[model samples]
Target: MKTIYLVLPCYNEELVIQDSAIKIEDFLRELVDKKIISAESRACFVNDGSNDSTWDLLEHLCETNAFLCAISLAGNRGHQNAMLAGMMMVKDRCDAVITLDADLQHDISVIPEFITQYKKGYEVVYGVRKSRKGEGAFKKVSGDAFYFLMNILGTKIIKNHADYRLMSSKAINALEKYGERNLFLRGIIPSMGFSYTTIEYDEKPRLAGESKYSLRKMIQLAATGITSFSVRPLHFIFFCGMFFFLISIVMLIYALVVFFHNGSIPGWTSTVAPIWLLGGIQLLALGVVGEYIGKIYMEAKHRPRYEIDKVIWK
Candidate 1:
């Protein structure tokens, strides 16, 4: 049998960590007992600098459970970086690692299927949600828009799939080569061009605590994902500039015609509308260009995404 280390990135999960850990530990043990997986399989909970007792609870759980390990970060490093830190810890040692949210929103039942696919020679097993049932209508609408936009923008990310997936040691090693400070795993994993498969499962609602995905974060993620993968956004600005230039030429011709016909200027509305419209478009173009420049600036610095403050295991 092969060993699978489940990597869970946690942040302020005090409300549900114990239950989530218990369920994960129990399921991992069942996999071991049924000879589906090796006894060395462990579930690692990464404490992403939670302000609550999340790390303390993990310490107690690690002390008592042989299958549980904990990684504590120096500060809150967001979900992707925390997950990356955990995968790096076990990539060289474990046969595979399954990363999921600590909130248990990812269905644990499909874990066996992930391992089965891994055994069948698939290097990557992606867990996709069949439907976002029971979710807020705005979340559903925005999520749909986000996925569609990402695909159109050249990032081949799986729809309805977050960071819940299985990666072989080989895949994980390839993943570590990505040294970008802004980590978008969904976009990067597909770019790996490895043999992979996806399993559809229903997403579960959070049983405890609130979600961390705010409107701002969602927009930021979408912008970052698009900017990280493609230069089309920069091209978009260029096209907008050309488009406005042509429009301005036509408008100038029309204004000259009116001026020669009546020896009078255009109406206030006509003059103000273009000023406001063109100004907005110019600012939008500048903002888009600035975002790309910012990404380049950050990448050139080669900063660490997350710092591991401690690693606890028994």
Candidate 2:
């Protein structure tokens, strides 16, 4: 049996952290009973400087559950870095590390599958969502558009896959060598060159707490992901410049045609300039729109929205 450490990153999850830890403890016991994971396997929760009682709850959980551990970051490092911190803490102690959120929106049932894939010599296993059936329409569209745009910008990412993934200790070691100041794991993990597979699960409703990732944060993450993985945005800007240059050349040709053929003609520039300008502007705008439409068309049939981050549990 393999020793697997599940690294759950938390921020302000004080309200439900205790209950969530209990749930993970139950799952850990099941794995231990089946002898699928070693008794040394643990659930490691990294507390990212929460102001509430999160760290205290985690401490109590560690005392009560043999397979539970906690790390308290000196300050909030947000979700990605907090996960990284947990992985770093547990890397030497375990054979594999599985990173997920504290709210348990990432279905725990598929965790056994993660261990199965790890046992098969796969270095990484991604937990992918089958659908976004219970989300709001705005979140659905925006999430769709974000990944669509990211792909268009040339970031190779598994659609509908969030941070929920398992990495072998060696893979985790390889991941730590990346030295970029602004790192996006979604972009970095694929480039790690690890053998990987995906297990699909129906994304569950958040068990507690409001989502920390707002719409603004979503855009920020998308931009970071794109910039980290690909320079297609620069390619896009260069193409736009070339497009304007072509329009300018066409206009200049029109001017030269009027000057050489009909020098005596009046109002040629005035007549053609507005028409060319408006037509060029409209075409450029439509071209930009079409690029996005092409992006959407590329992924419209693929994966569902990736994260919900919030759910008002009754």
Candidate 3:
């Protein structure tokens, strides 16, 4: 029998943790009863420095349930890092790991299909959402745009896939090789060469608690995804520079023609256009360079992505 570990990352999800825990426990029990996985299979929760009773609940769950294991981070390290921390902690103990959120937005029913895909030699199985049932139209549109932009930036991501996915031990082992401080799991996973497949399922409404991802976080995530995977952003600035330089040269020739033909004309428009255009171009170029430099600064710091404040296992 294969041992399957479910790694859930929680950040101030105290309201939904208990329900999430129960649902996952029930799912694992069903899998065991169906002989899909060994009874030794467990659900591991990584508490990402929740200020509430999330850690306490995880500790209690770990104590009461033999299949529960909890790792509490010292401070909030963002969702991707927390997931990475959980995977790193349990990659050695299970045949495969499925990382999911604590809100139960991702359907747990598709997990069996994920395992089936794994058995079929897929090292990675992504849980792709067939539909976003509860999200607003604005969110849906924004999400689609984000994916489109990511693709344009040369980051190949599985469409409609979140963190809810199954990864074989081999895949997890390969992932461990990536040690970048800006760990974007969704982006990074696809970059790791592996035979992978996807299972489509409808994303359900959260049973409890609001989504931890804010609009600002979504924008930040988009930026991280692009900056981490592609140099296209920097190249975009180069293209912009070339375009403006060409326009400036054309304008210069036009100005020279006007100067020779119609002598002594005060043309403020010509003077202001190049000044504003060049200034904007210079600032934009600097901004792009600064983005990469900022990332480098963070990497040079060599700080731990996440710190574990506590652990509970039984």
Best TM-score goes to which candidate?
1
**Residue pairs of candidate 3 with colliding backbone atoms:** 74-307
Model 1 error, position 174 (Å): 0.6
Off by over 4 Å in 2: 253-314
Each prediction's TM-score versus the true structure: 0.97, 0.80, 0.94
Looking at model 1, which ten-residue stretch has the lowest summed lDDT?
265-274
Whole-model alpha-carbon lDDT for candidate 2: 0.80
* Residue 277 lDDT in candidate 1: 87
Ranking by lDDT: 1, 3, 2
For candidate 3, give the lDDT: 0.88
Window of ten residues with lowest summed lDDT in model 3: 264-273
> Where's the lowest-lDDT run of ten residues in candidate 2?
305-314
Candidate 3 has a TM-score of 0.94
Give the alpha-carbon lDDT of every model. 0.89, 0.80, 0.88
Query: Candidate 3, 264: how far from true, in Å?
Result: 3.7
In angstroms, the error of model 2 at 175 is 0.5
lDDT of 2 by residue, 86-108 (tens): 88778998899999989999999
